[model samples]
Target: MNRFATLFSASALSTIAFGADSYAAMPHPGTEPEQQLETTITRLSPSAYNVVLIESLRDDHSEPPFANVTPQSHEARLVQASVIANPALSRKLQAQNVELDNIVGAETAADGSVTFYLR
Candidate 1:
């Protein structure tokens, strides 16, 4: 019975996977957008991370490249809020023309700067 259940589950999963991809309109043969990346960075003190990072996906993702950037006082609260109480940063983000509720990715530097990815 255990073996039967395992086989049944595998069969069901394979069916779902095959069905999900069969009707999809994929981009051109070699033009998948998976490799393309867009990233942004913000540095701060006691940086409160509002995003979750997947350790397994690090290889596919690009690291933040905000080195040599001048940290501004105004942008301090942008990436410095604790995960729980960051009302100011939230408000500022909402006011932006392109609101940023959460980041696509983020990296911390040895010098205590943070680079937040946008894509």
Candidate 2:
């Protein structure tokens, strides 16, 4: 009868230990999630901005660069690149009196660079 009581007490203690461990391991409901920031640089023209290959930039986790970017979020990066590249293109276009529409396509490079095609 004493042995049976000892065995039952051990089993009960182990069950309580496991329950406490599981509760501790569970994630808390109200924690703030982490946000990933964009680190990609775009080369742009009147056409498309060259984007870094998603496969090359992604880690083993397969998270893509700029994966969560919205169109509005990308405007600042585009405007900055255009400001830099447009001066030269604008000069040539002005000389030729040509007006181009907007960016269209990108040519991918194996070196993780993109050449934006202009119209």
Which candidate achieves the best TM-score against the true structure? 2
Candidate 1 lDDT (Cα, 0 to 1): 0.42
lDDT (tens digit, per residue) of candidate 1 on 31-94: 3132221112322333442333333335755743332222342232343332114454445445
Clash count for each candidate, listed in order shown: 2, 5
lDDT of 1 at 85: 43
Clashing pairs in 1: 40-116, 41-116
Ten residues in sequence with the least summed lDDT for candidate 1: 34-43
RMSD of 1: 14.3
| Ten-residue stretch with the least lDDT total in model 2 | 32-41
